[model samples]
Target chain A: MLMRCIRAEMRKLRGAGIWWVFALLPVISAAYGTFNFMQNREILTNGWYSLFTQHTLFYALFFFSPMVGVYAAYLWRMEHMGGGMNMLMTMPVYPFCFFAAKGAAVLAVTLLTQGWVFALYMLCGRTLCGLTGWPPLQIALYMLRGLLGALPVVALQLLLSMVIRSFAVPVLIALVGGVVGMALVAQDAGIWWPYALVLLGMNANRAQDQLSGGLGVYVLVCLGFTALLCLLAQALLTRRDVRA
Target chain B: MRAAMLAERIKAARRHDLLLAALTGLLTALCAAVRPEEDWQRAVGYSALTVNLSLMNAVVMPLAMAALASRLWDMETRGSGCRLLFTLQSWESLFGAKALRGLVQNVVICLAEGAVFLLAGRMWGYTQALEIPRVLWLMLCTFVVNAMRFFALLALSVRSGTQVLPLAVGLACSLLSVFTAFMPERLTLLTPWAYDVPLSAMRMHYDRETRITAYEPLAFPAGLLAAAVVCGVLGYVLARRAVRDQEV
Candidate 1:
């Protein structure tokens, strides 16, 4: 049933033109990152590590969470329309399956975006920055970790979009959350903030590994937050009366 | 016109649009609060606060305008693409009402932001006196830029019948504006979102070695202010046309 719901989501997303948003944002980030990286070569002497920070810093800090908000909002938009939520509630599928299906859809898009960001990083590093060697293995691990970190954000945004009928508000909240996350990371308390998880996982704006020896705790936190958000969403769906 | 404006106000009240405006102001205050307190004690502390406030405005205002504009139009778009609303009122009145209401909300946000800066300076026990005129100038600059962004997003929301496009553009503009602080002045003038930093009454300089930062006053960029006004008028005209010619 979950697979069926997921398939239905995929069908709804067909030709939604949301890909342009995902495709365009990274390009802008890469352009700004590359330009900044080239202009400051003397100070940015850490080669690929410096380049990684340039590419991911603003993207991770401002763009990624809200992009997820857009995706989640778009997914739930149809349901919020006339009589759609009532129809969804009456369907045979459990509310958990319905909400999980949305999460799965957003997760797939996030995975694609992470890959695209990595591709841009490598492309900019080798071609634009004129770096000679392949990106370090740690960069790949960062990308994977970024994907892991994004799971909680995706779940949280889906929950917000589900509850908030207005599409733009959730996106605004996501942007604010990202800014707050940056502040938390700066204060050395990022590990406890759900919004800060992706920034910490990506190791944005820093040459050194931010998680380092605490990878276990980071993973546990990400998983724990993801589960908690998903359960909260399921509970909301099960308990609330259908407004539509 | 009065009735239309009243209707817009009623719609905004229902949607809790004032709350969003207040939230935008609070977010700016929060961003201002993140600066180190030591910097606030410098001789040019108020200047530093002004610079920081403008940069924070660049980050927060564009998206807030987008959200506000999109929410204003979302009701119409959701209910048969304004077909019903058009039957009752002229497009010009509808556009004027929304534009005025949104501009009023933008004014509220700007005033609240200026209040935040003053309150922060007082709270931080700044050495320098707060410049009332400069704060008002910054507020005016922010309002013009945000009004321009609001019109552009309003047109996009009206045309697309979806909030996604406007929100995406807002997010992208906000991201770009953050980096614009590092770009050259000429380059910064080209993007509307980047105007907050360039039009600010103060400029900041940081010494990498000593980690000391200083703020200095800038000559007012009257030409840039003129350009922003022109762009805002153009956006408003374009948005008006979009509403008038929108196919029901």
Candidate 2:
């Protein structure tokens, strides 16, 4: 039943528009990261994952996560509007599977997007700096770090989608947050806010002399919160009015 | 009856777009005011331009062309307000009117803010008299780029129900627009802003090695501004079709 539910979620996610949304991740990441990489090509040589983690991680948390969050919310909104929730509720499956399937799908789509972006980014790097030796593990770790931070944003979007019927609101809210949040967070570089994970990863990857051991504590806290958020999302999805 | 129908749309738009515009204008100016003139490049210039691109294009303008277009076509989810403008308006005229109004209002507000910014800059003495023309030209080009933004955003918004994705896409495109600055000065012969201002005329090369050329005109804002008409018109046409088909 759970597998079926997840499959059904994937079916809706296959919508052409959603694919375009997914496609946006790499294009945005690559385009902007390229600009940054060119602007300061020195720090980028640490490796694929390190450079991306450093340059793109900060963006993933604040702007990228929020933007992606809206699309995540929009994914469920399809079900909400199509009356899929009520239809699924009648099935033999536990309703928790519904939210889980949807959330997992969003995560998968995000990974696919970020993954493609990573590939394109590496290509850009090679073109510019004659770089080689694909460090899959490091890049994977960097992506994992970004996904860990993305949990709260995804959870928040899901929670908001349940209450806010309008598909328009999430993007606006995310924009407001990204614009304002970056301004505030740019001040304290070491804070454990979900947006800073990429910066931490990037800094850690860069392994520059400027960083210290305090970053490990920040990572532990972020991962801890990410787990808590997943639990919170599952609980909310189980209890909330799916029909609304 | 046709006149009445048009009147109703104008009213409906005023209700949705006008209040939002005024509020957004105040918010934009307030946000811009918080930073000192020295930080203007980061705060107002790059950030505002970016958010306007990668973020909410309509939120900044209030009566964004997309909202106007979407509302006109009824692809947007229904509003709580029960008005005949929702039912009676044709998509073509509706989008045309909305796009036109949005352009005018956005430009006016932009000019007002520009004036205030200049006034503030003068009072603070951040620039000299010689720099005023260059600044004015930059502002003029930015205004045109904003026009393109309105066009591009409106068209995309009508096709995509979620306005943010398109806005972000536009933002990404704006970033891509920077690549034009890298073109050799002689290659920039196509547009008025680029032609009149001259790519070399506006500090084409940034000596970032020294970090002193941060104020240099990294790209021809005029070329971007000139693209506004083409992008805007194309956006309008696309928006009109989308609205007609109820595409979003």
User: Which candidate tops DockQ?
Assistant: 1
lDDT by residue (tens digit), candidate 1, B1-248: 99898888776665677777877776775666534456455567667767877887788778888888898898787868588888888888999999988988898888788777777766666777777888889889988988889998898888787888888888778878977878988888878767989999687888878987777898888888899999898888878888988765
DockQ of each: 0.61, 0.17
For residues A1-244, write the lDDT of model 1, one tens digit per residue.
9999999998877898688889999988998899999998998999998998999898988789989999999999998878788889888889889899998899998998999999998888898899988988988988889888999999999999998888888888888788778778888898887778888998986888989999999999999999999889988889977653
Candidate with the greatest TM-score versus the true structure: 1
- Where's the lowest-lDDT run of ten residues in candidate 2 chain B? B191-200
TM-score of chain B of 2: 0.55
Off by over 4 Å in 2: A1-4, A24-28, A31-63, A80-98, A124-128, A136-140, A189-212, A220-244, B1-87, B100-143, B156-210, B213-227, B241-248
List TM-scores of chain B, every candidate: 0.94, 0.55
**Candidate 1 error regions (>4 Å):** B34-42
User: Candidate 2's residue-wise lDDT over A1-110, tens digit each?
Assistant: 77887797788766546566566545655665666656666645566544565446435533465556556666766555557667655667776676677677777776
All candidates' TM-scores?
A: 0.96, 0.66
lDDT of 2 at B81: 26
lDDT of predicted model 1: 0.85
